[model samples]
Target chain A: SVFNVPFTEKSSPGSTPALSDSSLQSDDEEFESVDALEIYDLISSISDPEHPLTLGQLAVVNLEDIQLDDSGNPNEIAEVIIKITPTITHCSLATLIGLGIRVRLERCLPPRYRIIIKVKEKTHQSENQVNKQLNDKERVSAACENDQLLKVISQMLSSCK
Target chain B: MSLSLVHTFTGHTDKCWATSIHSKLPLLATVSGDRTCRVYNLETKRLIVVLDDDSHSKTLSSVEWKPTGEFPSLAIGSFDSTISIWGNEEAVLEDEDNWTLMAIIEGHENEIKGVSWSHDGVYLASCSRDKSIWIWEADDNNEEFECVFVVQEHSQDVKHVTWHQHENVLASSSYDDTVKLFKQDDYDEDDWVNVADLTGHEGTVWSSDFEKKGERVTRLSSSSDDGTIRIWKILHAADDQPSIDSKLPSTIKTDTNQDMWELETILPIIHHGPIYSVAWGENGYIASVGSDGRIVVYKELNSKEWQIIISQPHSHGVYEINNIKWHGDRLITAGDDGLVKLWELAL
Candidate 1:
């Protein structure tokens, strides 16, 4: 029933600057460091499959939840950990959202950056299962290889800048 | 039908946004989000040169080669809101690495989306997120480009700019869900006017190209976020009548009739997601690549109907395909996977 209705702007408290507007900001001149805001910018604008609102507007991706662990050496590999919160406890598309975030980071970031996408603790009903599915190398690759699933994920990310 | 991978160019560090091939040479140039432009030789499957100097600091979006020039010249558009012209002076030189920056045109306030050179290589049209399309004239004697027209008629960001195959006309697609046609004023040689605006797509129009069917019939193909490829047929009017509403200034109206373009047909949904790029191939094949990582080729069965002849799903894995262009029989595609793949139709 929710899918049939067109979502008009009903302001919520979590509404911030839209991801489309913030992502268009020029990158920092300093290329040596990877900022956490950049990671937030990448995933915040992803449209939800159930709702027309962005992840940022739904409070699914917050700047505070993105953590970047660098070795302080530019040549060494860096690790990025993103903790995502689903809008509902029983949201079925959590894994799909996580996959979308993972794919976006993989395309935008360099090879040296290791990405870890996880469901925020207690945010979903099947948090452990969703986390395992999101982080499993073979499972992630297999989901990406699926043409039908990839189409849905692509639609979720189509609104991203 | 099936397709085979010919070659894969793994030079760009990030997503390759646009690609263009030289008219007379075995060269293909591609721009990437890595802020670099790479030119590769199709014959040897080797990279000729990489243009990643200090000139471009942001992502390079589009690149186009001059159709007819004394020497090989390229126009590159970047996210830094500027377009750089690179030229090779020594045409006969064996060295392919002698590319020098000729001019830098800085006018747009935001990212430059697309740059295209006219068929005769006289005019260069570029669109930008600033909702404007600027036309530059090439002064061969001075080796410089002068800004001639800046048309800010689009209500939203202009995504792509393409020139007609046989005329000086230019077509631009925008995020406003419309495609506009512009041509030089018949009465005044110095004035460029917006002749028509096509508004059938319900979502953003990403790319468009002209296909010259015969002597008088010219067709236009456009890909949009609505997940459909639309074909429009261009008809020349015998009398002075505007087919669509004229957004042009009243002073630019002349007594002669202008060309009329009507929506011809809508192709079936080949890709489930948004289609980003559509290119009319040289050998009567239409190739399209989209966000679903699939490249689908369509061919006309009879005089009226078009059908998908070849469908290559997962051509670039899971990443979105940014651009697809046909160089002779081979189809060159670049995408967010950071790989430039060449595909040939399998017999």
Candidate 2:
């Protein structure tokens, strides 16, 4: 565990990027598309594991680090990639932070969305290792099945807007 | 091939984790998040006993039946970071507490993910989130269990471990995106070594099962987060061809088994999400379940080919099936819906 860092939720999601892209939907794009800002909005409110501050307020999660790829096809595989920069370079809790984001999206999003959480490069001491564990479906699911881990994750999401 | 719903046993208050069938009895044992291991009679399709212990503070993640025992014995793994060996030690097996907690094995620092008894029943292997697999040597009485060997070869958390039907080989799937095989050395009998790492999966390997009745050229069916089921085969070192062991080993074993398991083929992809479990039926079919809420069965067309003969969506009524096992011709599945279903395959 590292020193607790305090940061609270954004009053509203990053509406600038999503609102500026006022492009109209295509004929086949009937389903509401989930964009980067929306994905960020979904997880940005998650509070830090040791602090009261939300990931958005702590600047651990940024809109630019979110990416979504949807072909607008219902049956196709839709992917959501999120990269979070740790406040400290050698943060040991990076994996837990990433897992919190992954669990949040997995619970809120549809089954088609393949969520991938990674530590932003150069921000974490072991970025690749944390990324591997966070993205593993079996590990992620097993962690969610864990009562203690789930309690912490739920606490992180308790203050979400 | 088709699976007709033969029977459904619904009693667990929460999601079911894993189920195991007794080799010598008409019984099925399933563990669930409710922190209980339930045993049901397959012949009568009735709830026989609900085994519960006060020591289990969390979900029971896995249940396994010892292949041979005087009385029925079960190895139950849990998220409480302990593996409890349960059995009826009384001379007369007649009481409300049909099962008694024999021993609580605790060594892993994290939750135990899977527990499996070897084909011979002398060895019980358990994999855990601590990234280590522990093999405990037990007796026929099930009263004593000694942690004999520990293999820490997997780079990440180990999900599941299963033994070969009649061999000493043990295959373990892991969150490290690989399946590793371990065996006791032919020369160094006390030492358990990682025989091979079957890599090629781009995502986490969830579970792997060894094909039953295949003695010489053994086969392994592995399910993974990559949404692919792969078949791996290996002959005895004496029978394997010269082309084996072609994949270079990063850490060479100075003295180990010379045999090597090579990738045979990948099953036709059917499920839309991560496959959580795979089982090679004693009836010679490969059955699989996954997070997609689908049950797919495959038949061997030949040595090099496999065909999807049965594909059923929403088998558990909107819940993901976590574990599936084959009992002779019948298929048994445990789902997140807290239901254990028995299906008859109409070939």
Candidate 3:
């Protein structure tokens, strides 16, 4: 059952960094509206960091929805949900991919955005690590407003570029 | 299905998953769930390298030698979602005989299933349960490896990815019951195009091997959960370049591309259960093992008579035989029973 659940706030995958407050915007509704295929195309551009192939071509992107908050004002925040698979289920690459996804999303999407990238499971107990990874990225993305955090995310992205 | 243990190295106290043999070096590299990878000398039955000091917390799934020249470098994958490259032979000679960590590749969302070095050893390919494939290229001796491409094309857990022995192409199989082939021209950018998608197996395809014929001709043999072994040919009899639009269309293509490529299935021989492993043996013989606990040997006779050499039920109820590799003239079979059995044909 632990595997079926998506991203969680805790798991021992080297403490995931939290996002800084500057980039923090109003939380969007649980569901967001973004094209799954388009998001897939963007994230898939991030290489495996280990292999020379694209994650999209390798079939690792598990997508849900990208939507906006419907609270007091619907245009306040944008949200996206995505699931990523490592080449191997036990791989340490999840954290990097998660971080890469957050940086890519923040760079590609509009401002005042809230992206929730969860790790979906294909087998029992597989999503636990993915959730931890996503949580770690969320914390870092939250910290993205910081000059230093933005620099790290930018360096990470530029290294791939 | 009765598994007869041929060899069992009981040194490691954890689960062993990754295994590879160096073409020139007389050694074997194996990674374990114990967060350590052990190197062994088969001739002396002695421990060569104990890659444990700097290992992962969880299990390691795959390990391989760089496909280039004879170097003591190794590429390992783990549950921590990282691929660690080590070239500690020189460092070992200087100090503690340690295998220095060359690079740690951080990507993938789940555990990695397989890692392979290209024939030229210029690149590394890894697959994960996240249903994706990652290809990394080594720049030089001093620089760390970088991610060149990420292929997310499978619909389920990708179990294994194998490189074609002589070509720049790579093949991957997954729980989604499809095997994809990819080729990159000159390794220019992050884009590695998907050239073909071979289908037909109803269950998961576990393992595949590329058979070398002369210079240009090659054959791909795959084992599947559907309890069958199928062979697909990569070269045609006509010419170097055939019809461009004859093959299956690229799976990643948008509606803009009208050209397609085709891969005709040459033979689909049935076994008894899920075929977990496949290998190419002597004299055009293709061998496969499955959950049926049987090792079926099939050979193509004059392009017509595909005969079964032997279907020895080696394990009980298709014991979890994970892989079968050919070492010289003998066949080495490994399974969940923790046994590595060797078999020879009694001609």
By TM-score, the best candidate is 2
**By TM-score, highest first, what's the ranking?**
2, 1, 3
**DockQ winner:** 2
Query: Candidate 2: misplaced stretches above 4 Å?
Result: A1-42, A49-53, A57-93, A102-128, A135-138, A141-155, B89-96, B238-256
Best by lDDT: 2
- Using Cα atoms with residue i matched to residue i, what is each candidate's TM-score against the true structure? 0.69, 0.79, 0.60
Identify the runs in model 3 with alpha carbons over 4 angstroms from their true place. A1-161, B1-7, B88-98, B186-190, B235-271, B315-319
lDDT tens string, model 3, B26-128?
A: 6667665456777766556467667776656556767887756434778888766788887754523223365677778888887777888877787889988
Decide which is better by TM-score, 2 or 3: 2
Ranking by lDDT: 2, 1, 3
Model 3: how far residue B28 lies from native, Å: 1.5
Candidate 1 CAPRI level? incorrect
Candidates' RMSD to native: 14.2, 8.6, 17.0
lDDT of each: 0.78, 0.79, 0.61
Residue B107 CA displacement from its true place in model 2, Å: 2.1
The residue pairs in collision within model 1 are: none
